[model samples]
Target chain A: MPCRMTSLHQLLASVLMMAGLVGPAAAEDPNGARRKALHNMVVQDCGSCHGLTFKGGLGSPLLPDDLEGVDDSTIATIVLDGVPGTPMPPWRGLVSESEALWIARGLKAGVFQ
Target chain B: MNLLRGLTVLIATAVWCLTAAADTALRGTGDLGVIIERADGSACIISTTERAILSCVDGLGDLSHASAVFSPDQRYAYIFGRDGGLTKLDLLERKIAKRVIQGGNSIGGAISDDGTLVAVSNYKPGGVKVFDATTLEQIADIPATYGSEGKLSKTVGLVDAPGRRFVFTLYDAGEIWMADFSKPGAPAITKLGTAGKLPYDALITGDGRHYIAGLFGEDGLAHVDLWAEEPVIERILDGYGKDDPAMPVYKMPHLEGWALAGDKFILPAVGHPELLALDAVTFKEAGRVKVHSQPVFAIARPDGRQVWVNFAHPKNDTVQVVDVPSLKVVHEFKPGPAVLHMEFTPRGHEVWVSVRDADRVDIYDARSFEKRGELSLRKPSGIFFAARATRTGL
Candidate 1:
C-alpha cells in the first residue's frame, strides 16, 4: 500500500501539470455554430466516462440504434434523474435544466446525421 | 455478367416459392370435438366442429378472445375474458347464462374433473378467482402472500385437482400457488416459492402430488414437490448469459408447449430450442433432444405416443408432429400466422391454437397435424378443450 500510494501521487502530479498546460485555453473555446452548444459540452463532460464520440470506450455506447425510439423528454429524465440500478448518475445538480434539454435534442438529431 | 447473375437469382427464388407452396399439403384426421373461448364475462362453448370449425362471429356476440372451458359432459362451455370477465354458456342453447368480471392478464383457469368448480388465476394482481361451474357464480377470490402489481404476465396456468383444489404460477414474485376452493369465502392460496426465476407454466402428474414447471428466466426446469409444506424444488439448466445485464432474458427462456407423458414431462427449452424429458417423481433429466427453432408450445395425445408443436419461419408457420416415444418431428401442418397457444379438443381429431399476432385461433386436424380451419378472435392467447375426446373421428 505504501509504494502504490507513492506512484499514484506521482501520476496525479503529472496529470495536474498537464492540465495546467492546456486548461486555460479550453475554458473560453466557443462551440462551433454548426454543432449545438450543450451537445458539445456533453461530448466534453460525459465523454469523460463515455468516450468522446459517445461510441463508448469506458462506458456503454449511446449509439443511435440504442436510442431508437427514445425521445427528448425521456433523455432529459435519464440525464437529470438517472436510471435506477444502472451506471447512469444524476447530472441535474451539476448541470442546468436548459443544458440537459439541449443535449437531449442534439442526441436525437445527431443520430440522423 | 451482372444482368445474367440477377436473372439466375430470380429464377432460383421462383423455383423455391413453387416448391414451398407444394409442401403446404393439408393432412390430418379428426373433426372439431369441443371449443372453449372467452365470452362476455366467462368462458362459453357456442359451437362444435367435427371436420374443421371456425368461430362464427355473428352468433357468439362480443365473445372474441376469451378462454372457453367445456364441461366433462360436453353439454356446457364456460367462457371468460382473461382480462377479468368470466361466463357460462349452454352448448345447446348457444347463449350465455351467467357472466362475471375477472381480473388478470395471461390468466389461466381450470375446471374440476366432476365439473363443479372452476378456478382462474388472477395473474397481474396475484390472486385466484373461484367460480361455481354450474351457475357461474363467483365463489372466492384468494390472493397470494406479497401483493403483485398486475403489470407482468402472470396467472398463466390454473391446473385443477380433485375436490376443487389447484395450482397456479406467479410470473414476477417467482412462485407457484396452491389453493383449495372447498372453503366458502376467500380461498387461502399458499405460496410454493420454487425460488428460481419466474415459472411460466406447470403440468401436474397423474396423481397430482408432484408438479413439473417450465422454469422461465433460466435454461432450466423447476420440479416442485407440491404435496410438501413448501414445494421441494430442483433447479436444472441455467443457460442465460450475462451479456444481457438489464432486461435480460431472465424470465423468458419462454418455453411453452408442455404435456405430461406417463410419469415423464415433455417441454421445449428456449435456450437450446429443443424438447426435454424429466422424471415426474425424481426430477432427473431423463432425455434431451431438438424439435424446432424457437418452439413455443405443444399438445400431446392422451396415449403420450404423439405430441404436436408450433414451429415457424416465413417458410412454414405450421404445426410439427412429434412421436414422443422417439422424440422426433415426423409431420408438419401449415396453419396461418404464428400459433401462440394450443389445446387438443376432446374429440382427438383437432388442436385449436390462438394465433396471437394474427388475432385469431386456428383449428387443426390432430392426426395429420394439418390446418382444418380456424376461430377468428381479436387477440387470443390461452386455449383449452372441454375434455379428452368422447368418440374419435376426423
Candidate 2:
C-alpha cells in the first residue's frame, strides 16, 4: 500500500468544506427551525439505521465538505438515481425532486432538526 | 377498471418506496469498494485497496486516543470515557447523522461475543455503560473498585466473564479492575496487586482466575492472581535484562503486546526483542522464539502457529508478515507506513491494517496477506469493519 501521510482531522474538515457546508456554519439561517426540520427529517427517517445525530450509524458520515458546491440537481440525481454497487438504494420514485433538495439543503445547512 | 388500475399504481409506488429506502439504508460506501457483505449472503470484494477506518467510540477531548470497537448493529460507535462522546456514522443514508457527546474517556469496550452489551472500561471513575444495543439507551453502569477508582486513562481492554465480573486493566496506570454486572447497581471491583512495570493490556484465562499484563517499564510480563483476595503478581519473563549502553542517555527497555494462547501466556520482550512463552503456573520460561530484530508488536495468530509482526517497513509505514510454526516469515509486504494497529475479522479472513500516517486503511487476506481492497479516506485511523450491511429490507 502507498504510504501517504495525512491528518484525518484536516482531511475531514477539507472534505466537509468541499461538500459546501463549510464557512462559519452557513451564516446561521434566519429560518433555523424550518431548515433544521428538513435536516431532522433525514435523520429521523434515515437515521433510524444510520444515526440520529450526524456522523453515522448504519449509513456513512455525510460530512458537509463532500456535499458542498455540488448543485442541488446533482444531489437530486444521487437520491433519485442512487449510487449502485453499494447499499444506497435509489430514492427516485419515493422521493420527489423537491424532497431530495430538502435533504440536500439540510445536509448543506449542517444542522439536524 | 380505472379504480383497479389506480390501486395497482399505489401498490407499485409503495413497493418502490420500500426498495428505495431499503437500498438507501443499505447503500455501500460505494466509494471504498471493499466487500462489506452483499445481499446474497456471499462476500463481495470491493476493488479499492485502502482499508476501512474502525472507530469504536471516538472521544472529543485529548482522550480521543481512546476508542472502542464498533459493531454494525445500526448504532453509534462511542468513544469511551467517564462521559464519552459517540461517533455517529450512518452508512445507509450515507452520512454522519449526529454526534451525541457523552462523558468519560473510558478505556476498552466489549460487545458480548454475540454483540449484546457495549461494555465500556470506566477507569478513574470506574464503571461500564451497559447500553441497550439497539436503542443506545443507558441500561446499566457497572463499576469496579465498588465504584471508587477515579477514571481510567484511556488504556483499558474489557473481556467477557459469565459468572464473574468482566475484567479490565488501566494501561497507563498500574491496575487490573474487575466488576460483575449481572446484578447491576451493586457491582464489586477486585483490584489486583500492581504487577509488571507500567502494566498496560491484559487477558483473563478461560478459567478467569489468572490475569497478565505486558509491563512497559519492567523487563518482562507480570502475572496477576485474580482468585486471591488481592490479585498477586506471581510471574515474570526471563527474556532479557535492561543494561546501560555505555552512554549517559539510557536506552530504557519497554514491552508491549501480550496475547493469550490456550492456557499459556505468549509474551514478547524488548531487549532480546523475542517472542517468549511463559508457563502461567510456575511463572517460568517455557520456551522462546527469537522474533523481529526490532520486534514491536508480536501479535500471535489464533491458530498459535503464526505470530504476525511489523518488524521492518518504510518510515511511517509497516512491513508485516506471518511468522509460521518454524519461525519462518510466510507472507511479507509493505502495506503502508506506521501500521499502527492490526485486527482480523472474527472469522480470521480479513486483516484490517490501519496506516495512520498514510491517512488510508488497507485490507488484506489473512491467508495470502495479499492486498485485497483499500479505503481512501481522511485520516483513516482506528479502522473497523461491521458485518456487511446490505440494501434490502429497508
Candidate 3:
C-alpha cells in the first residue's frame, strides 16, 4: 500500500511540472521589486501620452474595452516592436519578451488600470 | 492727564497696526509660481524667494500633462490639464477662481498677446477653442479639419504670437494654422501650409519672429518666418539623423523648452542622445553636443549663458549643463530618480528641479552648481513662474 501511494505522488508531481504550474522556469514572474517598477512605468511613463486613466490622449485609449478585439499576443508584439510610422516606440530593450507578455495580459485583464 | 496720554498712545498704535495689515494684503506676486502635483491632481503655489510652498489648491482634474500661462498682470494663472480641464487660479487669493471642462483631451494652451483670450489645443475631438480670459466663456471653436476626407487633426504646440494671433500645428494633417483674433469673435484662420510629416511640438522665438515645429515621423523641422511678406513653411535639418540607426524614443523631446543660448538654438535631437545647435540667425545646423541618453528638455538660462539638458526614461535621472560658448558639457549630476522639470528663477540665479520619484523639488545655484534647498511635495512636474507673463511662448 505504501509503494502504491508513492507511485501516485510521483505521477502528480510530473503532471504539475508538465503543466508549468510548479517548475523553476515557471517561477520567473518579475519579482516584487521589479513588478513595482513596471507598475510605475505604466502609470508615469506610459501615462504621459496615454491618459493616466487610460482614457486616451496623444496615444489611443488603453482600457480593457478599448482593446477588446485585439489578442494578447498582438498587443504584446506591438508593445515590444511598436507600430511603424507613429509616435509609439518599441520597448524591446527596456522590457523582456516575457515581461511584455505579462504586461499585455495585465492590460487585457484591466490589471494595470 | 495720564488717562489722556494713554488713549493717545493707543490710537497711534491702532493706526500703525492697520497700516501694516494693509501692506500685507497688497503683497506682490512677482516671486510666486505654481508647480503641478501631477499624481495628486493639485498644484503648489510656491514662493521663489522664500523657497517654500505657500498653498496647495486641488480639484484641477488630471494634470498628467499640465501647463500654465500667466495673465498680463501676473495675478492669475490659466492652467491647461490633460483631461480637458482649464482652470483659472488666482495667485493673490490662493484659490481657483474658475474652472471649466473645455474638451475631451487637451494638450496645452496659450494666452493671447493682449491677455484677453486663452486658446487651447485639443486631441480627442481635434480642434482649437478660444475662451474669454476673464469670463472663461467659449468664444470660438476652430476645427483642425484637413485632407479630402475632412478628418480632424490633433493640434499641438499652441503659442501666443504678436498681433493677437495663436499659431499651432496640426499633427495628422501636417500643416500649421494661424488664428488671428484681432477681430475677437470672428477669427481669421490662415492655412500656413505643410509642416513636414508629423509636427509634434513647436516653439516661437523670444522676439516672436520665428515659429519652428519639430517633426516626429521624419528627421527634420518646419520653420516659418512670421515676418515674411508671404510666410512659407521651410523644412530645415532634413535627414540629419539618416546616418545613425534609429533608437526607441521613450519620451518625445519638448520643443517649447528649446534653448536659445548665445546665438545658437540648443535643441534635443529626436531619438538620439545629442543636442543640435542651430544658428539663431540662419537657422542652420552649427554643431551637435553628444550627451547622456535621449534628451527631453534642453532649456537655456534666462541670461542665455548656460543650457541645461534632461533625459528620458532609463537615463532620466541625470541632468547635464552645457556651456554655450564652448558647446561642451560642463557639469553632470543626478538630482534624483525621475527628474521631470527644471525652472530657472526669473533672473537665472537659481534653478528649481522637480524630482518626481523623490516627491521633492530641489533648488540649485546655477553658477556654483551646489544644492541650495529642497521642498517636499507630491509628484511634481512643470514649474512655471509669473515671469512667464512677459516672455513669448513659455
* Candidate order by decreasing DockQ: 3, 1, 2
Interface RMSD of each: 18.8, 20.3, 0.7
**Comparing 1 and 3 on DockQ, the stronger one:** 3
Which of candidates 1 and 3 reaches a greater TM-score? Answer: 3
Which structure is stronger by lDDT: 1 or 2? 1
Assess each prediction's global lDDT (C-alpha) against the native. 0.54, 0.48, 0.88
DockQ of each: 0.02, 0.02, 0.56
DockQ of 2: 0.02
Per-candidate chain B TM? 0.70, 0.64, 0.94
Q: iRMS for model 2?
A: 20.3
The residue-by-residue lDDT of candidate 3 on B1-394, one tens digit each, is 9999999999999999985674467789989999999988898899899898888999999999999999999999999999999999998888999999999999999998889999999997888999999999999999999988999999998999998999999999999999998883689999999998888899998788889999889998989999998889999888889989878888888987347788998988999888988998998999899999899999999888899989998789999999998999999999999999999998899999999998999999999989999999998988999889988887
Clashing residue pairs in candidate 3 are: none
Between candidates 1 and 3, which one is better according to lDDT? Answer: 3
Question: Could you give me the TM-score of model 3 versus the true structure?
Answer: 0.90
Model 2, C-alpha of B4: deviation from truth (Å):
41
